[model samples]
Target: MHIKEFFSPDHTRLSFEIFPPNQRMSLKAVMASAARMAAYEPDFMSVTFKADGSGGDQTIQISNAVSEVMGIPSIAHLTCSGIPKTELPAVYDELTENKVKNILVLGGDSTRELGEDAYLPYAKDMVAYFRERGDFTIGAACFPEGNDPALSMDEELRHLKEKVGMGVDFLTTQMFFDNEVFYRFLEKARTMGIDVPILAGIMPITSAGQVRRIKDLSDAALPDSLLRMVDRFKDDPDAMFDAGLTFAENQMADLVAAGVSGIHVYTMNKPAIPERIVRDLGRLFHA
Candidate 1:
C-alpha cells in the first residue's frame, strides 16, 4: 500500500522501522523479528538502507519479504550519499519489480564525504526524481531539534518547504527524547506552510552505551532528568534497559495523546521493545 493513503486526518498511524541484515545468519534472526513485529499489525513498517555496497540489493530483498511475504506495507529507505549516480536506477527497478511502493529518501550521514559525481546532491532532488517517476509514496527525513549546524533554522525550514514542494508526501523525524521538541518543530513547520503528515521517530534507549552513541550521532541535548536516569542506572544493564523503556513509553504515550500523525518506533531491529510499547498503547488508535 502507498503510505500516503494511510495518513488520514481522522486517525493516527503507527509504524516500526528495521534495518536490512548484512550477514546470512543475521538475516534469519531479522526475518524472525520481522514476523514478530508483523503480528502486531502496525500501519506500516520501514527498512533502512545500509551504507555497505550490497545495501541496495539487500534492501529490496528484505523489503519484499516484509511487504509481500509478511503482508505488511513497507517503506524502503534510499540514500544518495557515497553511492554512484548511475546505480540508483537499477535499484529502483528492482524495488518496483518486487512491488515495493513506499520510500524514505535520506541525505545520509553528513560525516561521509560525497563523491564528485553524486547525482542527487540533496534529499529534495531525490524526492523530485522519484516523484517524476510517478508510482511511489515518498517520505523525507526531518530533524525535530534541527539539522546540520552550518544551516540556520530559517534556512533549514526554507529547504524543507522546498523539498515538500518538490514532491515529498510526508516527513519522518530523527529520534528525539523530548516530545516538546517535536511539538515545537511541528509548529514551525506549519508556520512555514509545509503541511504534509509528520511521523514522530522514536528510539527506545536500551543500554548505557547507547546514550553515548545517541549523543555522538545527533548531538541532541540530554535533559537533566534523562541525564540523571542515565547516571542512576548506567552501571546496571538490566535496570538501565528497564528505565530506558519506561522513558520511551512515557514519551510515546504523550505524543499519542497530542495527536501526532504517526508514532514511528526506531526498533533498532529489536522486536521486543516495539512489541511491549504497542501492547501498552492497547488499541489507542484505529490503526
Candidate 2:
C-alpha cells in the first residue's frame, strides 16, 4: 500500500524502518529481520538513508528488494544532505524503475565541509521538488511537541501549510510520548485548517539502557509515568524489556482509542521490538 493510504479511517497502519547493511554478509541478518517482522504483516517498511551519506545507490536497491521481492510496500528515505539537488533525478529514476512509489524527503544532517549547513533546510521544498515531476507520494516530518522554543507553532504550521500547498500527500511526526502533546498538535492543525493525514510516530524502547539513547534520538517528551518504569526496571534486562513493551503497547492503545489515523513504529531495525509490538496490537487495537 502507498504510505498515504495508511492514513484512512478503517485502516490500521504499522511500519518498521531498517538501515541497509554495508556488508553483504550482514544483509542476511537484515533480510531475516525483515522476513520475521513480515509475519505480523506491517502495512509498509521504510529503509533509511545511512548516516554520513554513503548509501544512496545501495539504499535504492535494498528498498526495491524489500518492496518488490518481499511483496511489501517500502518507503525510501531520500535525504539531500551530501547529495546535490541537481543530482536528485537519478535517485528518483532508480526508485520509480523498481516500482517503489513512496518516499520520505528529508533535509537530513549537516554537510559542513560542503558549505551547506541547512541540509535541505525545509521539507516543503523537497515535497515540491519531486511532486511537480512524478507519480510519487511523499511523506514529511512534523514535531508535535512544537516544544522547540526556537520555532513557534505558528512558524511550524506555516511550513506545514507550505508543504501541503506544494502537494505533500502526508505527514509523519517525530516521536512523542505524551498523548496530550499529540492532541494539542492535532487540535492546532485543525484550527489552522491543515488537513493532511498525520501518522503517529511511536518508538518502542525495549531495554532500559536505551533510555538515554532514545532521549537523544527524537523530540519525544518523557512522561513521568514512563520515566518511573524505566528507573524502576533499569537493573533487570528481562523486566525492563517486558515493561518497555507494555508501556509502548499502552501508548498505542491510547492512540488507537483516540482515533489516530495510523501508527508508525520506529522499530530501529530490530525484529524483537516489532515482533512484540505486533503481538500486542491484536488485543490493543480491539480491546
Candidate 3:
C-alpha cells in the first residue's frame, strides 16, 4: 500500500526504518536484524539509501530482501543526490517492478564536495516528476521544529503546499523530542489546507551521549525538563535507555490521543529497541 494511505488516522499503522550494512561482512547482521524486526509484523518497513552514513547498492539489494523474501511492503528511500532530473524515472520503474509501491523522495544531506546544489534542489521537483507517471506514492520530509535556517515556518508551509500541488501524497517529519512542535505543525498544516496524513517520526535515544550529540545535530528542542533528567542519568546507561523509552511512549500516546495519523519509529536497524518501544506502547493501546 502507498504509505500516504497507510498512515491515515482510520488505519493507525506503525512502521520502521532500516539501513543495509556497508561492508559485505555486515550482511549477516542486517539479515538477522531484519528477521528479528519482521517478527514484530509492523504495517511496513522502509529500507534506507545512504542512511546517516553508509554505502551500498542501497536501494535494489536491501529493498529486494525486504519485499521479496520477507514479503513485507517496503518503502525505499530514493535520493536525488548528484543524479539528474531525467534519471529518476528508470529507478522508479525498477522499484515498481519489485513491488515497492512507496518512495520517500529526499534531496540528501549536504557534504563537502556536494556544494550548494548537492541534491535535487527542492523536493517539489521530484514530486512533479513522479506525479506525472503516477507510479508510486511519494513522500517528502518536513521539519516540525523549524530548524532549517533558510526557511521560516511560513516559508516551509509554502514549500509544503507547493509540493502537495506537485502531488506529494504524505509527509514524514524529522525527529522532534517535544510533542508541542508536532501539534503546532499539524495546526499550521490544517490551516494552510495541506491535508495529507503526516506520520510522526520518533527516534528513541538510548544513551546520554547520544542525547547530547543528537540535540546538536537535530536542533532537537527537547523540553528543559527532559534535559535535566538526561543530565541526571548521563552516566547511567540503563537509566538512560529507560528514559528514552519512556519519552517515546509518552510522545506516542499523546500523539494518538491528539488523533495524529500514524507512527514511524527510527529503529536504527536494532530491532530490540523498536521492539521494546512497540511492546510497551501496546499496553497503552489496549488499555
lDDT of 2 by residue, 222-280 (tens): 88888998889888888888888898888888888887877888876778888888776
For candidate 3, the C-alpha RMSD (Å) to the true structure equals 2.6
Backbone collisions counted per model:
0, 0, 0
User: Which candidate, 1 or 2, has the higher TM-score?
Assistant: 1
Model 2 lDDT-worst window of ten: 110-119
Candidate 2, which segments miss by more than 4 Å at Cα? 22-25, 51-53, 117-120, 283-287
lDDT of candidate 3 over 1-287, digit per residue (tens) = 66565654544567788887765427788878887887887777887776545563556567777877887777877666634555566776777677777878876663525454534677688777777876678888888877578888989898788888888888888888889888998899889999988889988877777777786778668788778878888788888888878888888888877777777888778887778866877654433
Model 2, residue 183: distance off in Å is: 1.0
> Model-by-model lDDT, in order?
0.84, 0.76, 0.76
- If both were scored by TM-score, which would come out higher, candidate 2 or candidate 3? 2
| Candidate 1 clashes between residue pairs 3 or more apart in a chain or in different chains | none
TM-score of each: 0.94, 0.90, 0.89
Candidate 1 lDDT over residue span 194-223, tens digit each: 999999998888877888988878957677
Ranking according to lDDT, highest score first: 1, 2, 3
Best candidate according to lDDT: 1
lDDT of 1 at 14: 87
